[model samples]
Target: MRPAPAVVAMGVAGCGKSAVGEALAAVLGAAFVEGDRLHPPENVARMARGEPLTDALREGWLDAIGQRIAVSVASGQGVVAACSALKRSYRERLRGFCKDIVFLYLEIDPATAKQRVGSRPGHFMPASLVDSQFATLEAPAADERALTLDATRPVGDIVASAVSLLGEANS
Candidate 1:
């Protein structure tokens, strides 16, 4: 049997990780997992207040997401997860969980991200924290397992690009 594919959609807030991840999962015939749902209420509240989450605050959340990936891997299920794995260390934690893991970095400019965040209603992530996200983000270039997609493109295009990248990698 072919090994299961585990794709992680990663980026800062408002980079369309959730949207792209869901679409990519559908395209790839994989199960979709939204990482934000795994965040503890305290972490959510902190981000909602425009405060950056400290490593201590993010540790449990990262572990939870990593464990979920491990579960999917063990089940032989293809999984696509939406998460802001902003740091290399965080990505490494996920790498420890699944051997077939690939990261899809949704690259976007700050202005576009801020506009999207501001226009979106009823979202906990405030536009004011966009700068902080940029500051915290460590782009995942140089990682051969990573694919950088321009998130400013249309959703259809983004999904197509991700699908193509995944297919190429898995082939």
Candidate 2:
């Protein structure tokens, strides 16, 4: 049997990357990695204080995710990771680790994102940073192996779409 394909659930903070990623992973019978948990302590503190992370600050976090992707790919076990790959460069960096990785972009508007972020009690990212996330985001280009979906939809619906996409990609 062919190995399951890796997927990255990517978007701004409140775009439901984690929810979709977890659901997709469960359906795919693949491992799920919450990218937020991999952030360094200092980065978490900065985000909690509403400070946006510079590219330099995010390097280590990206590296950690990349390492995990490499491991999963090498083992032939798929992984679904929730990450805010805001910049094109960041996504490119991750692609270096796994050539077949597919990006699932959860498209969301700023108002909804801010509302969601504000309602989430303990997440390190603050609602105020929603603007910065928008500022930083470079939606996946046409050539990239990516699937874009509406984040405001129900999680089950989103996961269903992702599963369909994965099935197509894997075939």
Best by lDDT: 2
User: Which 10-residue window in model 1 sums to the lowest lDDT?
Assistant: 136-145
Question: Which parts of model 1 are misplaced by more than 4 Å?
Answer: none
lDDT string for model 2 (75-130, tens) is 98889999998888999889888878899999999999999999998788889999
**TM-score winner:** 2
Q: Rate the local accuracy (lDDT) of all candidates.
A: 0.90, 0.92
Give lDDT tens digits, candidate 1, residues 29-67. Answer: 888989999999998899899898987888899889889
lDDT, residue 102, model 1: 94
What is the C-alpha RMSD, rounded to one decimal, of candidate 2?
1.0
Stretches > 4 Å off in candidate 2:
none
Q: Report the Cα lDDT for candidate 1.
A: 0.90
